[model samples]
Target: MTKVRTINNYTGIDTRSAIGTVDHPLANMDHAPTISELCKVFLKDGVALAVNASRKALHEAQLSPLDITHVVSTTCTNSANPGFDHFVCKELGITQPVEKVLLHGIGCSGGLASLRTAANLALGSSFRKRRARALVIALEISSLLVRSELDSINDSQDTRIGVTLFSDCASAAILCNGFGGVEAEPVYELLGWDNRVIADTEHDLGFDVDPLGWKVVLSPRVPKLTSAAVSPTFNKLLQSLPKLPPHYKTASDFDWALHPGGATILSGVEKAMNITPEHMRASYDTYINHGNSSSATIFSVMDRLRQKDMDKLAPDGKAKDFVVGCAFGPGIVIEMCMLKRNMSHIQRTLVVESGEATPSHTESERSEGEAGQEIEIQIEMGSMEGKDEELGEKLRDMHPEVPQQGDSLSEALNGVELD
Candidate 1:
């Protein structure tokens, strides 16, 4: 117990959520729950969480259930026959004949992978001259695997720190093609993206299936390996975009929405990119508050970056307009995307009225404005709903205090170097 607490403290995660707390069925059990039991809990609580997230996203986009023409969902947790997205669609009263895509085996990068897939689908719809509104969802119920992981740790006496790092979450986003007549507000313009796998590092990270549930396989070298790949991938992503201001050449110039895989991973990336902690304020905040919720963590970080309080927390007391989104997964795969904040209508009008040079817009933006093609992306974190309200309320009640730099686990792992 002492060792577990110490390692968890090292990870800097204050709290995380599972299916149940006070009335947890497996709390008093002598052994880890069977796969059957875990599935039952996922079906009940997991589905509800995904539904809650989807509802919130739909409400925020000001669209009805029927407005969604395609559904793209990803998960490293559940493997049902019809998939959770089907149930989510049913619960949200989306009975239309919508195309559905369920992505598996993408791991933590699944969120961005799903977004990339949705963007392609939206583009295809645009080419076909049809309106398309694709809903992308990423959900994970990692907490249930805790007992199984503990059992592995106890039996093998292996220092598996993964048990202390994962939690549960569901996040959703709405992406609409410019062909539609609908006027939607976009938080970020999808400018360009890049995905690549580092060579000879397959054994470094994975999540394998187990009878009890699944087991996380993390190598100590992961932080070093993942960090080393960031620079090249980020450069490739930047090159894919149209000509931009010279100041955007480096990583620190833009804001970041990086998946907080762990304390070391975050620090390693910061060091490799030569970015300040303030550049990834939301990533660290999400890790400290929610831990790593697999594929869902990236969206949480992105959502946090948009909050008013986050602006006050920025280095200059205002958030940057250009942002970078990055995440890593099992294959040592790195996903990177360039995003520019969509100027609100009022902001655009003010710039025009003041006779100031307007900021550069992506091709998608110009299409939406001039060619009547609008591709709007809106990402949302799931809200507490149904039985999960108890967990949500508890989370809200807790205050998240950012620790000082000297108190961070990063210092301990700062010397980790790649082979």
Candidate 2:
């Protein structure tokens, strides 16, 4: 137990969410749950979480369920017939005939891979002169597999660092084609993307299925191998997007939204890319607060980077307009993308508030008093709302038997260091 705690401290994760908490029936069992039992829990809690995340994304995008033309989902934790996306669509009232793609066998990079797939789908629709709004979802219920992993560790008497790294999360995003002709305000523009696999490292990282559940095959060399691949992968991405701002020449020039595979992974990538911790502030913050939630973690980091508070933590106290998104998966696959921040919406709002003449509005639409009142309302809303807490509550409600806060594994490693 002491050794495990020491190793877990190196992960730099303070806390993480899991499905089978300290009080869950599965946690109390003497052996791992059957495959059928795992499937039941996944269908219930996993699908519910996916639906909730998708609804939040659709709401924020101001799009209706019917507006989603395609669904691209990924998960390393569940492999049931019909997949969880099917139930997510049904629950969200998206009854329209929509194309759906579910990606499997992909580990941590699944989120970015799903986004790449959705981007291609959106581009295809544009080429056909058709409108498309693709919904991308990544959900992982890794906490449920704790018992199985523990059993394996005990049987082999070998360390499996993954047991201390993974958690549970569901994230969703809406991608639209520019040819849609809809007046949509996008937060980030996907300029370019690249995917590459490092040579001779096929066995270094993997997620293999077992009779009990899925087993994470993580080699200690993962951080070093992934770091070595970053420079070349990023160069290729930048080469493909030559139209980027002149000031953004290298990795350090732009902000980063990297998948927090682990503390070492983040630190290695930072060194390889010649960037600073401030460049990946959101990634560190997400990893420490939520741990690595498999395919769903990248979106959580992206969401954190866009928050107003993150601006203060940006390099030189000013956030960059461009961002680099990177993640690594089982095949030692590196998924990278270039994103340009869209601040037109915020700029336009500021212009209107200052009573300045703009192309869209010659006069102020709202009085100064009304504008101030609206700002106050938004501030109050932001302060009162906690997205993670709300989602945790919903999951706990769906599975009342599982305690949401305390993790059984963490309890076992009673002396684990937490930030």
Each prediction's whole-model lDDT (CA)? 0.73, 0.72
Per-candidate TM-score against the hidden true structure: 0.84, 0.82
Instruction: List candidate 2 stretches off by more than 4 Å.
Output: 344-419
lDDT of 2 by residue, 69-165 (tens): 8999999888998999999999887888998999998888999999999888877776676667788999998887878878877887655667788
Per residue, candidate 1 scores C-alpha lDDT tens digits across 227-279 of 99999999888888756677788898899999988777777788999986678
Candidate 2, residue 63: how far the Cα is off, in Å: 0.5
Best candidate (score: lDDT): 1
The 10-residue segment of model 1 with minimum total lDDT is 345-354
Enumerate residue pairs that collide in model 2: none
Prediction RMSDs, each to the true structure: 9.2, 11.0
Q: Model 2 residue 322 lDDT?
A: 88
